[model samples]
Target: MCHSQDRTPSEVGRDLVQWFLENQRDLPWRRDYSPYGVWVSEIMLQQTQVAAVVPYYLRWMKRFPDVPSLAAATEDEVLLYWEGLGYYSRARNLLKAARLVMERFGGRVPDTEADLRVLPGVGPYTASAILSLAYNRDVPVVDGNVERVAARLLDLDVSAKSPEGRREVLRAATQWLVPGKARFYNQALMELGAVICTPAHPKCLACPVAARCLALRHGTVENRPVRSPRPRWEELRVAIGVLRENGKIYIQKRPEGGLFAGLWEFPGGKALEAETPRVALVREMEEELGVRVKIVDKIGVVRHAYTRFRVTLHAYRCVPDPPGQIVRPRACAAWKWVRPSELDLFAFPAANRRLIQALRKAADAGS
Candidate 1:
């Protein structure tokens, strides 16, 4: 890779800013430029595609609109808005942060990176982004897109997944940051990476800073930003018990602070190596809900993939052994017996959503 330091960072920054002003996408977040909007958009954009987040962002803005509204919302309501977004913890943290901002910051999103970092789930990248974009602070952001751009622009040969590699990329981004033009500069760099300097096939012909890109000069843009190997996904078999009594289905809320936090789902758990789906359902019900269940029949299997693992959910229709014994939640946060028609009122995981649809279809056929 070539490191021709002929052009100054200021010159490169100016060119990128000019390019951004002309070619940037007309996103809804860009229209408002409010701190709340930027914070929500950045959170949603993490580990998700821009196209996927747009409608969600719009609906969320319409619903919550600002810090106080979000802070005042119940966890269930917040999770409802975030349904199908997959990562439930993001919504939980956003709610927590909103409440903290209301209590500590007087309902205003913090302006400085340090102040913003105190909020739950607000890391360096998010804090820097909110600061730079919303407050117009002269800070640099090094998200995946910006990291890729930096790797090619400076021809950094380090694997961005490594600690040293990440630090180097951040340093390069900071070094090239245009003071007083941070909002445009940061967005421009990220936009360039997203559209032009993409990972798979970068459009070098359209890149404004292509003239200054070291990876382009060295003909290694395709492989400039190296990544470490990702861990293999673990497969697990789960048994979900669809407990029904007097026309209401039993559902429980997941505990806060983990994957799918605070979302509603049918009671179930991973099957032990020696246990069948029915056996697992019996054990899971007794342990999780403190109630014995008699599995009536198999409902069907549903497969779902999470970020770290894949699960094959074996669902079964079950009845309380004692026939209307009080269903108590021993492991989860809460439990409810809701009419099947009321399932849509609660937010459930994607896998559970599929299960609900299947359950409804089965009920319809039986009726």
Candidate 2:
């Protein structure tokens, strides 16, 4: 029973599960009840769209089908498969979780939500998701969609924008979860939000429980998920592009620390105060690659967000002027010039992929 004096969660839970059976999407993870499969899908789903995750999930499942397989895979190989999927930390955490499962649980994923949370990178939401979706356990799994749906249902005024506000919403959502049938119930609410109960112009008429929805009844569905105004993000001047020659693009592998480490990337860095992009590029190349480059044409710019900072990467196609032997100076592990066709052999950041695309276009135009 829900501790809150509101309506019993059991009835709501039953309605949701009943609705889900008739409207659930045929996701790959749902086809099987393997905890490893569910865990991989959940991790891949974090900060990634479902449409985008489909191929990656399928490829990853084929490559590393189980916890033991994932545990046996090298980090480089795992990152190769995970290329273009931002937030490299999630991939690293997946490996850590697999290793933990192999060593402690004899390569078996734990079924209980509490036990699942103890694994590296397994949070409250992820643990609950795995427990309910994979193991058919009763646990409150509140993701963004679930949060939005729950917020609209209860007409919660608390800010879901801030970190603390989001936490508060999680607590409220957990209070409304029905014990012992959380699997289908949680999935149903999530599905409803993903399809009909969208962020804007929700199909209230098609909602299963629209007649009982507090937001719809009160005409506040659009604004029910309240939040404080976002702070102005600090801007960064970034440099990114390929150093090219003879159909080979120069790339350097980042060190095993910081963002996108142990991954191949275009040689670029942040511009210091009042520094020109060319100056920054030259300095960064010298510092990171121990080589000199002659700036060519400005390729383009890519706008990206990383944590708290908003960055505008100024891309430029350049050529190594000095043509010196590449050296891995400062925070770099290795350097190489690889053809575009073989780029998949190494893991690269999204920005690097964009750089490669731009370089290929340049090569085609030059030809």
The residue ranges of model 2 lying beyond 4 angstroms of the native Cα positions read 1-8, 161-179, 244-248, 325-328, 337-340
Would you list the C-alpha lDDT of every candidate in the order shown? 0.89, 0.80
The residue-by-residue lDDT of candidate 2 on 191-299, one tens digit each, is 9889988888899888887766777777778886875677778999988656878878777788887878888888889999889887898788878777788888898
lDDT of 1 by residue, 155-207 (tens): 87778757877877777778778999999999999999899988888899999
- Measured with C-alpha atoms, the lDDT of residue 260 in candidate 2 is 88
User: Can you list the residue pairs that collide in candidate 1?
Assistant: none
lDDT of 1 at 100: 98
How accurate locally is residue 288 in candidate 1, as Cα lDDT from 0 to 100? 86
Highest-lDDT candidate: 1
TM-score of 1: 0.92
Global local distance difference test of model 2: 0.80
